[model samples]
Each structure stands twice: as C-alpha cells, then as structure tokens.
Target: MVAKEGYRNGKRALVLLVMTALLLAACTGKEDQGKQEPEANKPKEPVELSIWQTVLNVNEEQFMQEYGSKIKEKFPEVTLRFIPYKGKGSAIQDLIAAGQMPDIIYASVGHIFFGVLDPQLQFDMTELIKKNQFDLTRFDPALIERQKQMANGGVYGLPTSMDTLVLYYNKDIFDKFGLSYPKNGMTWDETYELAKKLNRTEGGVAYRGFGMATGAMFTVNPLSLQSVDPSGDKARFTADEGFKKLFENFSRFYNIPGNEVTQQNITLAKQRELFDKDKVTAMFVNTGAFASSTYKDTMNWDVVSLPSFGETPGVGSQPIPTYFYIANPSKKKDKAFEVISYLTSNEFQQYAAKQGRFTSLNDRSIRSVYGDDIPYFKGKNVKSMFPVKNASPTPLTKYDSVALASLGTQFDQVLIGPKDINTALRDAVEDANKKIETEKGK
Candidate 1:
C-alpha cells in the first residue's frame, strides 16, 4: 500500500511540472509576440534621474545647460534633475528620511564616508566598470587611489573633477616689491624665503606675504598627512609624525613679523579678502584662479604648483577631488553608470576643462585646455596647476570632516595662543576624537 501511494504521488508531481512548463511556454510565446510592451512601457514614464550635487557650484539653470542638457542629448528619453545642497537646507538628510536617495551623488573625497558610506548607500562599481569596459587609467592615479581608499579595495565612485591647490600670487604685489613671480616646482622652504622678502608694511597698509582662505592647504599638506587613521579608526593628526613635521614648518608663516595672524586677518574670510579683493597679500597657497573669483577680472594674478616639501621632492599636495557615485538604492544603476561614465569621458572632460573647471583626467590634451574659453584666464600660467606628481591619497573616514574642522581651532591656538606645535597637535586630535564620539552618539 505504501509503494502504491509513493507511485501515485510521483505521477501527480510529474503532471503538475508538465502543466507549469506548458504555462511558461505559452507566456514566452506571448512575450515573443510583443505582448511585453505593457511591462516595458512602465519605464517610459519620463525617465528622470535625480542628482544630489552642485556640479561645480552651478544653479539649476547652469547645471541644466552644462551637464544636464548633455545627458539629455544622449539619453533623449531621460531628464537629469538636481537636488541641491550647497547653501541650501539639509537636502541629503531629508532625502534619506524620505527614503528617496538620488541616482547620482557627488562628494568631495573627504565627504565620501560621511555623506555616502555612513548612509549605507555606497555602491561598488567594479563590476559595472568591467561590464562597460571603462578605462580607469585615463584618470590621475591619485584620484583612483582615493576612491579605493574610500571603499575597501572597491571602486565606489568615478572621479568627475578636482580642485587642486596652487600658489596663487598677486602679480601687482610682486611688482610693487620688485620680486620675480614664483616658478613651478618651488619647495616650501623656497616659498618661505620669498615670503620673508615680501613681508612688509608700506605706507600704513599691512601686506601679508603668505596665507590662504583657510587651513585647507595643510589638510592636503605635501607630507601626505591625513587626520584620521583607517587602521585604528581614530584621529591620527597627533599620532602621525608627518602631521607635526608639516605643522612645524607651516607655522613659521604666522610668525613672519608683519605676517602674524592678527584680529584683522586671522579669520578665513579676511585672509581670502586680503589676497583676493584688497590685494594686500603677495602669495596665497590656494585653489587655482580660473575665473572662479569675482575679483579675477580685475586682479593681476598667476599661479605655480603648491609648494613641494624638501622631504618629498616633486610630490605636490594631495588632489582635492570630487567624485560621482551611483547610490546602492538607485533602481536605475545601469543608466546611472552610463551617465557618470559619460561624465568622465574625453568629450565631456574637454568641455569641462575649457570652461575653467579642472579635469581629473591625466590626458595632456585636456590639461592643456585648462582655461581656453575663460577670457580672464587667457594669458595666465594655468599649467602650474598640475604637479609632476600628486601626493598619495591617505585613508579617510566619517570622522575626517570633524577632525579637520577641529584642526582649524587648534591651528589658531598654535599661531596666536601660548600653545606650542606639539601641544596644538595633541589638542586638535583630542578635540576631534571628542567630536567624533559626539557625532557617533547622534
């Protein structure tokens, strides 16, 4: 009786399997006969790809004109839309709360872990890159390493552009002092010597020798120091010897007699205004002047590579990079990858380079066209923007942003307060770790 029951059950199972196969075959026949349009047509509902980046600090109209329109031209069925953040209210966080993460997200290298990784939205594009046969070698190796540093041996994003540090000098100030313009590949020590010559107060107007808008330059210091250590997952600004070595040397600028950090020029805004609008400062280690400044048209300025250090010959400051990522929750990852891949392509890069935005591509042709279309940059030595080599990218974490912010406070203490360099370094890291812990609680 048991054997008979088993045979009957096996027969029933075979019959059901045959019926299911026949039903699937009939559906396949319908699909072959173009009955799949209903399923396919759902995606035809005006393919809108949302972007959560400023795209070189552009407004909606500007972004649409430059990058958005181009994407529309290629993917005619698609509309590229932006979810702005700069100078806007908490956009990304709101999106996260609403469960509406954008298809493409842009982040500066430092913000990678905070904005993308912490949200658990980082998507490794390695397989997509391989599937698309995208060549990674075209980009500067440092930028590639930066992406890998953000992910654990995975390419989380593709570099779209960079903001490189250079020694921006007021040529008029140099002329006033009878000093020659700084040349490319000058060491920081050489820059310090030049700064000494230019540090003077003539006719009651204080002229600073060397300064920057903020302590941003030191964040990418030539010593290749990073605020946080990935190995230990804590602030490394105090522990790393490189940080002290860099800070010890850089702090000299603040002590250069007339160039001391004062109440008038101590703030970041004042430092930038002094060099840019007031034109009191002679040299500034800052981002390239690519028609970016409102004063660029009026100011007589040129740039050289960010001063290299004696300890690291020919290595420039770490590249300040911005990358494009396809968020993990994005339903249209393929289209997102296609759009971002096109963004990093030769054609788009050329267009971007001409528009005075720095290109991340290692292509000389793109680099040569750095400011071709910008009238203000016609005769400026923009080539000094690219160094012979970029310093190796260091490990980054969510704590990095907090750590860097605290450094500014501790850095101020070094220049003006009674604290020594070592003391300031210790405070910066300690304050940063405390902030990191506070943020962790949130």
Candidate 2:
C-alpha cells in the first residue's frame, strides 16, 4: 500500500512540473511578441503622385529640367506624374468622372474664385501647415491673407508665385509728349493729371494718355469692394460708394477730349496694338505687360508702381498668385504636403527666380536673383515690382465671375456715357443678383 501511494505522488509531481514548463513557455512567447519592432521604424513602399495643371505647358520644360530632377534626387522612391489638360473646358470634370482624380492641383486665384477648382474638394492645410512647422511668414502677408480669406479662415492652398499690376509706360511716347514718366507710388488723382498731359493729338495721330485692360480696375480698389456676398446671397455694389468712385476714376481716362471715340470702342487687342505696334499710348496700366512678346524689341518701355487709391494710399494692386492645392481625396496627403513644402522652399524659389518667374517668397535674397537668366529684364526696373504693399484681396463670393461680368458690362456703358455711374451700378447689381439666383436654382 505504501509503494502504491508513493507512485501516485510521483505521477502528480510530474504533472505539476509539466504544467509549470508550459506556463513558462507561454510567458516567454508573450514577451517576445511585445519586443517586436515598431511599425513606424519599418521602411515604407514607394509611391507615385499625380499633379495636374491648367498651364503646365508654360512651365513643363522648366519643371522637367529643374524641378523634376530635384524631386527625383530628394525622393528616390517617389515618382511624380505631371499631366496637362486644356484650361477652359470640362477636362478636369471628365478626369474626375473617370476616377483619375489628381493628387495635386495647380491654378491661379481666378481659378478658385471663379469655381473652376472647387475649394470644397481641397484639403484644409491648416493642420498640415502646423504639423510640418511650415512658415507662412516666408510669403507675402497679403498673399497669405488672401488664401486664408478664400478658405474662410482655412488655408487650402499656398501661392507659388505672385504678380501685381504695374504702370507700363512707353518711353518713346513719354519723350515725344515731353512729359515726365509716371512716378512710383503716385495716387490715382496724380496719375490722372499726368495722363491728361499725355492725351493729345500729335500730327494727326491720337496719343492716349492711359488705358487698362478689361477687369483690371478691380486690382486698384480696396479689398472691401466685392461684387456679391455669397453667404448673404446679395449684391454688394449697389449701395457701395467705393464702386461709384472706382467707376468715375476709370472713366476719366476716356472722358479726355479727342480720346472719347477711341476709348469707347477700344478692345484689349487694340490696347496692346496701341502700346506695342502703334506705340501711341503713353501708359498702360496692367499686370506684367512688359513681359509679353508685344514689348519685345519693339518699344522702349519701363515700369512704375501701380497707382494707389486715396483709401489705401501707398498700397499697390492685390497680388494675383498662382497656387497649388492638394486634393482631399489623395490617399498620400502627407507625401503631397512634403512635396509642396519642398517646392515652395527657398532653394526652389531661388531656382524659380533664376528662371524669370516671380516667386512668392518675400526673401530679399530671392528677389535679388529674379530675371537673372532672362536678358530681356537686364536693364528693366524689375525691382519696382516689389517695394509697394500689395492690395488687399477682393472679397470673393460663389458667383464672383458672373457678378464681375455684369459689372464689367455696365462699366462699359458708363464709359460710353450711355448710363450714369449710379444707374450703371444699380443695373449691374440687379443683373448680378438675377444671375446668382438662377445659378442657385440650378
């Protein structure tokens, strides 16, 4: 009986030992699992990003030659695919319908304001900007503010380059008239006085003092002048005194004696021909007009700061910036931001400056290198483009394009004396509201 009891005890002890060994193995396995490498430290697979631009043709060669290589060198695992499409039509919509949504988009401020690129589809970049520690101060303050305003206080995109309206004057015309060149930082009143002196009949040829492109007058106005209020769904120009003043300011150029007929019928092409081919216009108030082929080797021209209004003295026209926005549908947002941040970096901006493209960076060093590669701008007052303060961005609404179009048509009526300033503005407000209501119903 004692031997049997001892055998039972030995069997029980062996079972206990086996159970203890199993428990130890299980705990060791759990500790090994816990010690596994973190996912963040692991290498990520390569990614290909797509970028679409309406004006890619203009910059394609430069991008391939300069930016493309830089991107490859910096991100060897990433591939950039640039696709260009027609700017004016439904190409982008077709692409979206086909499920080929781009990871990034590049366009001008007009594109966003006119609803060509849907702002709602853009990723709010405020968080990305904060996370990346990207400095907004590096760019022009006005540009940053404009982007913020368009996004309704959210930064949806960033400007890559900025262009402002400047006074482009034909030196030969100024000399022939024996009038001094328009000075930088001149007020609209002062400029008009100068224009009066330049508008005259010289040997059966009409020498107009001043002319601006259609829709260019808005650039010189205060930021408060908006055509419509999308949020309120109302016209903003009817009761605004600024709109009246703006109309009067622009019409004075046409009201000059002997200039009435030409100003009433003049088109943009005619204005360019007057400045470039005919060389009769004393001054052309436009943005970057000197860079056009019209001024190439034809007329001796110079640029001065755009005329400022009494309301915002010393402030030039608002910056029309070219912006790049990342798509909300992009799966690779972080990577897209990385590329955008790099593209807007000082290094890239300097290269852009060298390529004669105006940079958005407010760096004096970058500005110093602008137009270095282009012989056309060698002796020009390229620096005149920088010194003045940018005009506040025009408050935009959903129906900005329609409203502006209506206003522009009425403005022409005012110039031709068919309608008074107040009547034209009232009619414009009515027309714009009607259009906006129709669009909303759709």
Candidate 3:
C-alpha cells in the first residue's frame, strides 16, 4: 500500500513538471518572435517639405486652404510652409539669397522670366521630365515656348494655373445708353463708338466709357508685333505703321471730352469699385480678377471677346502661366521632381479649375472638365477669348525686366499726354534695345 501511494505521488509530480516546462517554452517562443522583427519594419516618420505661396491675402486664404491642405495629406512626408509675399520685395530677395530656399517656390509667370535670368539659381528639369514620362502636352506649347525664350533649354517651372483676359461690360449701362451689347468680333473702332455713346456726366456722377491698365500696353503691343513677324526679337512695332494704328486705337478710349477716364494713378481695385458703382461701362480683366469679383457676389454683367483691332481679334488678356519651379541642383532633386509631377497632374488641375474658370493646356482634360455643354461658356462665342493668338509672356532677362518697367512708365506718359505716341514708343524701344545689348555684352 505504501509503495502504491509513493508511485501515485511521483506520477502527479511528473505531470506538473511537464506542464510547467510547456508554459516556459511558449513564453520563450514569444520573446524570440519579438526579437526577430527588423528595425526598418517600424512606421517611418513622414518627410516635411516646405512650400512657399502667394495666397495670403484676406480673400485668397480660403480658396488656397481647400487644396493646400489636400497637398499636405497626399504628401505625408511633406509639410507646406505657406509664406506670404509680405509686401516687402527685399524680404524675398534676402530669403532666397540666404540659401534657406523653400523646397517648392510658387510664384507668377513673371518669376519664371526672372528665374531664367540666372541658371545657377534655377533648376533644369529636362531629365526628370523625360525620365518620369511627364506629359508636356498638358500645357499650351505657346506658353511653353514663351517660357523657353527666357533662357537656355532648361525648363525652370510648371504652370499649374492660368488666367486669360476678357472684356466685362455692365448690362444696365448698355441698356441705359441705348447701345447694343458689344459683339464677339467688334473692332476697336466699334468699341470706341460704343464707349462714346455710353459716356455721361449726370446725376452727381461722371461716367467713363472705358478704363485701361497702364501695364496693359505690354500685352497690346504684341498684336502689332505679330503683324511684323511675331517670332522676331527686334522692335519693328516702333517703325511699323500698323503699330501706330494700334496706339491710335488705344487713344480713342482716352480722347473722349469731359470723360473721367484717365490711365494715370488708377488701380484694378479702383476700377472694380467704379464698375460696382456703375461709373465705368466696360473694362478688360483676367480670369483671376473676374474670379475674385464674381465667385458669390451678384453683379449685372457679361463678358465678350476683347474688342477687335481690324481683322485681328482684340487681345484682351494673355494667359499668365503661373508655375512651380524646383532647383535643378537641389540636394533633394529626386523628391522635388516627384512633388512637381504630382502637382501638375490632371487630378490637381481639375480641383483648381472647379474653384475658378480655367482652360487646360491639356486639351483632353479640358474637355473632360467642361463637358460638351456649359451654360456660362455657351455661344456668345466664349471660344473667342481662348488660345489668345497674340498672347506674349514677359521676356526673360534683366534687360527685359528693365524694358517692361521702362515701357510701363513710358506708356503711362503717352496715355497722360506727356509724350506723343511715336516719340514714346521710339524712345522706349531705343532705350530697351540699348539695355538688351548691354546685358548681352554684344
């Protein structure tokens, strides 16, 4: 009996030992499994990319936020640093000079003109574009060619948004003056006649037929240049009879007696106020300006083709190709290229288009965005404002910048009668050419 009891106790002890061993083995296996994981398996922290933009104005931030935040989410590794142009030109120069440049620089098409002035400062995106099979067909070749004229073969930026100019007229003003609405193919002479009929000084108000932007001559001169070989660099317009006709045509808007319209010291905002107050009957405006005015506000107005100049359709506004540029020699070139590719895609463009009216440089995508029928774009022949046949972008070079600035000043002088049309254009062209020759060191 004693032997039996001892044997039974031994069996019980053996079973307990086996169970404990199994539990210990299981715990050891779990620890070994934990040790086998590689450090790389852990979630990587995102990359933070800084983006600089000009959407800091009070009315602009909301629209910018709609897509700006989406960009941040899409590029988890990127954090956009929205920098506003603080009304200080020196600040931009200083920030850019200090080597603290943002990963992405978003500026106007004008900047691209300046970017090409110095190759070292701008990145050449040719190879990356080829490698990624990025479709350049998405952009207007005319726009692209204009950008290429800035410098060498290196592409410095990609245009994500564009705005073309059109003529905006107040319907009420036309009705009150007993004048028909401006037609799609109306010539400058016709526009002048309409303006003359509409000008009025009554009821404690002086009404002007039209308003002009002093800087607008740079765009207007292109039509005359087109008449003298659009591809040439020389200023044939200075000597061309057609160019004189162009100036005379512009002068009609200002020649009206007792008209309050004067080009000197007038601003876009002031013009808008005039339009709102029914003081100005018509004005030329770009898509950006129009978007800023009509997004949610009620205005009794309509748009039509820019007034024609004889056989040539009136060139209202050129499509300013605002773009994003990556530094070619950037330390983070690969990533920068990726960001650019992503930004200029059709998906992103559609988002921007929905907020404001845009004609895609990519034809197919444009068709997709604006279907075969759109009410606002219907047959007052909206196509007249498109492909701006004579649209000329700013020339790239220090000389071009100086030329444009000098030209703007001179144009203002002509409009205000400080200089005759021929003398002003001649002197301006001579001064500009001299600067150009000096810059080229030829």
TM-scores of all candidate predictions against the true structure: 0.85, 0.83, 0.73
- lDDT of all predictions, in order shown? 0.81, 0.77, 0.59
Candidate 3 at 132: error in angstroms? 0.6
Identify the candidate with maximal lDDT.
1
Q: Would you list the rank order by TM-score, best first?
A: 1, 2, 3
Candidate with the greatest TM-score versus the true structure: 1
lDDT, candidate 2, 414-442, per-residue tens = 87767899989999899989999898899
Worst 10 residues of 3 by lDDT: 224-233
Q: Which residue pairs collide in model 2, if any? A: none
Question: What does candidate 1 score on TM?
Answer: 0.85
Please rank every candidate by lDDT, starting with the best: 1, 2, 3
Candidate 3 wrong stretches, greater than 4 Å: 1-45, 53-67, 87-92, 96-99, 113-119, 202-204, 220-243, 258-273, 283-288, 293-298, 314-317, 357-360, 364-394, 430-442
lDDT of 3 at 153: 55
Residue-level error in angstroms, candidate 3, position 234: 9.3
What's the distance in Å from true for residue 365, model 3? 5.5
lDDT (tens digit, per residue) of candidate 1 on 1-442? 9999999999999999999999999989988877555764555446788888733355778777657877887677788778777654545677888766799998777677656887788899999999999999999999999887767788999998888777888998889989999998888889999999988888998888999755777677666777877666578877758778776777898789888986666898888888888889998877663346454677898887878877677788788888999989899999899889999999999988888778989999889988888888878888556788888877776677788888878878788868888888888888888888898788
lDDT (Cα, tens digit) per residue for candidate 3, span 1-442: 9999999999999999999999999999999988886876665456655555543342336535544666765666665555555555523455577665666666666555343334345666888889988887778765676557553655777777666656667776777667788776567777777778767866766667776554544543435243122244434446556556666777667778644445633554665567655445455433534634452234566666666566656554456667777754356667777776776777766665544445446655553453123344333334444434635554443444556555555655776776898897787777766666576675
User: Could you report the Cα RMSD, in angstroms, for every candidate shown?
Assistant: 10.2, 6.8, 7.6
